[model samples]
Target: MSNKATHASGASSDGAELRRRNVPGESNGSAVPTQAEVDNKKSHKPKSQSSILSTLDEYEFLIAPLIFTFLAFFTRMYKIGLSDIVTWDEAHFGKFGSHYIKREFYFDVHPPLGKMLVGLSGVLAGYNGSFEFKSGEKYPEELNYTFMRLFNSAFGAVCVPLAYYTARELNFRRPAVWLVTLMVLFENSYATISRFILLDSMLLCFTFTTVLCWARFHRLRHESFSVEWFTWLFLTGISIGCVCSVKWVGMFGTALVGFYTIEDLWNKFGDLKMPKVELASHVSARVVGLIIIPVLVYMFTFWVHFLVLENSGPGDAQMSSLFQANLRGTEVGKDSPLEIAYGSRATLKNMGYGGGLLHSHVQTYPEGSQQQQVTCYHHKDANNDWFFYPNRNKPLYNPEEPIEYVGDKDIIRLIHSQTGRNLHSHTVSAPVTKADYEVSSYGNTTVGDEKDHWTVEVVNDAASNDWTKIRTLTTSFRLKHTSLGCYLRAGNVNLPQWGFKQIEVTCVKENKPRDVYTHWNVESHWNERLPASDPGSYKSPFLRDFVHLNVAMMTSNNALVPDPDKQDDLASHFWQWPILNVGLRMCGWDDHIVKYFLLGNPIVYWGSTASLAGFFVLIGWYLVRWQRGYQELKPIEIDQIHYGGIYPVVGWFLHYLPFVAMARVTYVHHYYPALYFAILTMGFMLDWVTRPLARTHKTIEWAIYGVLYVVVISLFILFRAIVFGMEGDNKQWRHLRWFEKWRITD
Candidate 1:
């Protein structure tokens, strides 16, 4: 007998009632029962096998998933503040919080909600000044770090629970919900990112929560299109908008929620063949819930800082009202040359750089000239060309010139010493004497022939094998000529193996054979001057000890400006190096922060790509196996629910396209959109995979299921290779294939 006929006859009657009650038990009767009888039987059922397992069938499919979600929450909140250092971006948030609580909203790169939340925490901690939370100070240091990290950790912790609810709402089995929650919890990316002091984790939390709410609404109230569904839809919109305010990447969540709402509306009306009154109400409710509510929520989150703060600055107001401002008027004021030019100013308002335009200008220089001019401000000379002047002559410094002393003497000394060493002493010219030589003794005098006026004697010291020369001479010369010049003269000199040593010289009147005067003994030589003190070596007393102490105190106390240097570093660092700097700033120093929010431990920034590929491969494998199972069941003629319907195909295609596009993008932030799409697609795919199992299966069906599994595995490997190879040197494009080239281009 056919499976459907069997279900209709004999024990199948009770089995149908069991299916209606969604209870697992043996049937004892052979006749079909009334709805009231089935309800009565359900009420009389015993629940002793397992409380938890029984609760799963009694309450809803979501209970087990919710329990699994607690694992993620615990991991995110565990030991969040191991690192005591106040990172660059954390300092910025700390400052924003301080200012915010003081009724002052400062303009920043992002909207106000994140800063407000952080500030609210600081206010709770009784933050006072920049130096209140320093280490070893009056305030508790542990509390300081924990306070700053609390919101991010809490938000991140909730994502696991949100994922569970999302999966359960899609009719996922307990195992699937547990798998997804565990993946979210243990996945290095999700775990690490929860500890950050940045917006990405918060954005993820808000986005995921919004998705969960939408899914719940879909499963429970979507069929009836109730007022409660509209309320949940509004809440979802608010969450999505709040996420977008934190980071623009959260817009992907907004889009997903919007798509789901529209789909919900269409499904409600289309099922009844678009009846006018029913369709109008459905369309109107979706318009209010999805479009109008989300826009309002987005604006509300963006403007809350402005409303709450008393003295919001012009910059703050501009940033908070960015979407409301007139772009063309803002553009006109920014075109002045007096303002600094850097780049296109279109994104500047949204990015919080008002009253400025960024532009690049070319510069040019003439041949053989050391001077250059900015081409925008100065016209180039007629002779200037963009060609290299290989043969152009430039003035060279003469070593003999006095002013040339400023040139590098070290290089000249090296060359000259090497040349002297290479040449023979006999080939060297003898010293020229233009004046008479003189000798003086403290108690006696000695005279020598004019040709032998100078006598040279060489002495060798045991410590050094080098010879030292003593020259005795009668000399007369003016003191001014040689005494104050670059070179010094001396008498009774001692030479070391390295070079010249302590020497002294006496000044005399020209042509006189006697000493006129001396400036004491002149015992020390000018070349042997002691090293001068370098002013640069000196550091401030504040910086050497007190400043860092102050910063520590401030951070610990949850005070404003915990570290001013760190705050400045975030702004300037991001402006200087946008890509790497922004990523690092957002990730923070906490390993958990990068792990949870970025989707993998950013320690291996590329791991997300691999995980993404693996996830898709699993989905593809499951699909192939499901198809194979269907083929095998065909022979048995067992009537089963065919799950791969028009809706599933549409959902999968819509969802997968975004992820495929994301994998090919250059920027990592683009992955958020891909993640949003992939998740929804997986949900739809799961729905398709499970629907067929609702019916009775024969042995042939089970065999087909096994064969399908093998087929899926093979197809996954093949598809993965094609997708991964298309990325080539770009690991980010691992989801794109040659056949899917449009994803890369898009």
Candidate 2:
């Protein structure tokens, strides 16, 4: 028969006929199948139904996940109670836990649910005390940082199993499961951060659980909605709520889940022939059970503690109930005064409400403070009134020309007739030499003011008057006030006679012969006068005020300049090593979200980048290869295997990219335990993508395997650079240096 006819008949054949043809063993009177027969049958069968439990025996299949889970557990639990000292935010969280245990419903930036969980752990650790939310006092010294960290570590341990379940839901093969589990085991940040008394590990655990539940929900949709499905959905919701309680960023998971539900609803109802109302009700029921129930579960998990806590007053309890009810009711207002007040009060109380902490105490400068200052070198009397001169200082006056001014020691005046603009009355000091004139304007000019602009004019060696402009006044500018002082303009409009060393006019005045000084000298004098100990001196205030300002300005200027040399220094000094510094620069010194980004959470940034890149690649690969072997690959067989199903392939790629990318950004101090879960998830995805291709084309299978090898090598190099090159000074340059090291290795 022809190949096409053979393929058609092969498709029509029963499993028994296929097995008989494929199996090597003789079927005689109740004899067991031979190993070779089983092997041959398995090889011919599609991979979708080929479980490791059947191929390697159940024992071997079970051992790997168990071993991986144990390793993950050990890594998390080994340093569980070792670090005695609390790091930066640990102290605040510890106090919050104490407060929660004492039943103090004190407001905090984070929801109270996470702290309540920590409080439960604290109680277990023998920290029975009255919680003082403000001073953070009454914390049990016996609990220690290690004990506090243990709770998160244990949660981190739970993540491995959660990851496995998630992978299994996606029908990942044994190899993919193992690869993901192994990747999670070695992820440094997830490991390190999990061992600290912070919310990140807990956040990660909850996020993994949510994803797992979501995946299960997706897989089990073909069956009628059962208690098991509801259970997973509920758990997923609880995890999301728990995450939100720990940090607001947890809401992202909730958003993702909601999106998934909408997609599910669309798929279920889009082609239905039922009435509009019936269809709507059906979709609504699914949404309520899957999406709404989980959200409520999450919210209720947080509300339970608030309701039960003794310190949570009746009003607080009412408010908590109201908030939960609002979420259920879909009353998502754009802004909530209560939430704003709660956040503001919590931050203020935590930081100590002294000095400028109070809103009323914040400094309020006058409106003109926004405008630049303009200083003129005109005469000032004892009362500091302008000295006016009536036409004595003409524009074309010679050095020996006699000048007259109508003025007393108490009052002075000046008149100028250039450009028809009058210097009718002004304060004039003694005659300032060219050098002195330059000094007076130094640093005194506002950024765009011409009087402050300085330029060096090159005069010809032969002629005193023949001078050429060496450089334009693009940045620096200098002015030479002659015997007759010139009227200074604030803008960059040039004086007609002031170019190329042409000394035209000089202003001589009759005030005390004061030494002209540069702005630097004035600043120096201010510094000296204050002597570093004087509280009222300008230097101290200027230093304190201008540091942030200057840093911001320099960073902005550096970005615009595009000088790679400057960028190299800036990146080295401020942008790369301490990822937080880069976040700060990105945020323009805003401490809210930028601070969180810097805390070594790679999923938010790097993971996102990797996911996007991986997604495009997968899409491209699928578009190219999906129909290439249509003649050889039967649709029925494809359905049975479905290893290369589009959904599974996408899921696997997304699942692993986050893990690998996050590992590349992990730091010693902050661990994201979810990376392990991510890796496991990706492995399953890869297995799905590879198995289909493998059955059809060995070359494609090997190509996929080669890609994985390259990915692993690249990840190894990246992790090495992050681990070895970073100096952990929380500066931008260090981060750049770390990046540089990675680039060099690459």
The clash tally of candidate 2 reads 43
Overlapping backbone residue pairs in candidate 1 total 38
lDDT of 2 at 422: 17
List, residue by residue over 1-746, the lDDT tens digit for candidate 2.
43223322233233333222110111111134679987898898776567753644445445656777887777666634432334335666766777666665444445556767777777877776443323222234555445656776787777777766565554454445445554555454455556655676777787778777776666455433466666666677667667766655466566656666776667667766657886676576556765676556555655565454544321221121212112212111112111111001110100001000001111111221212112221111111111122222223323244433211111111111111111221222212232222212111111122222221212111111322211110111112232234322221111122121111121223222221111000000011111122111111122322232223223222223223233332222212322322321211122111111122333222432344345457656655676674353355334323322344333333333333343122232222332333354356445645655544565766666566545543553344323222322334434433433322111
Candidate 1: worst 10 consecutive residues by lDDT?
A: 414-423
TM-score of each: 0.46, 0.48
Query: Residue 128, candidate 1: how far off, in angstroms?
Result: 3.2
Those runs of model 2 whose alpha carbons end farther than 4 Å from true positions after fitting are 1-36, 39-56, 59-62, 129-141, 273-282, 308-364, 368-612, 624-685, 692-746
What is the per-residue lDDT of model 1 for residues 1-746, given as tens digits with 9 covering 90 to 100? 53334332212323233232211111111223468986676677654534555465555434554565565655666556555555434656666776666665345656567777777777666665343322222324534656667666787777777776665544443333444454454544455556656565777788777767765565445245556566676777677667766755566566666665666566666676667888788678767766677667656664465455544332332221221122222222122221111110111111111211111122212211111111100111221111100111223333233321101011111001111110001111112111212211111011211111111111211122332310010111112212111111222222121111111122222432222121111000111112222211112132212222222222222212123233342222211111112321232322232111122322122222333344457556656877877343341122111121222223334433444444221234433324433443443333334334434433443454445334433433333322111222333433532323122222
Q: What's the distance in Å from true for residue 705, model 2?
A: 7.3
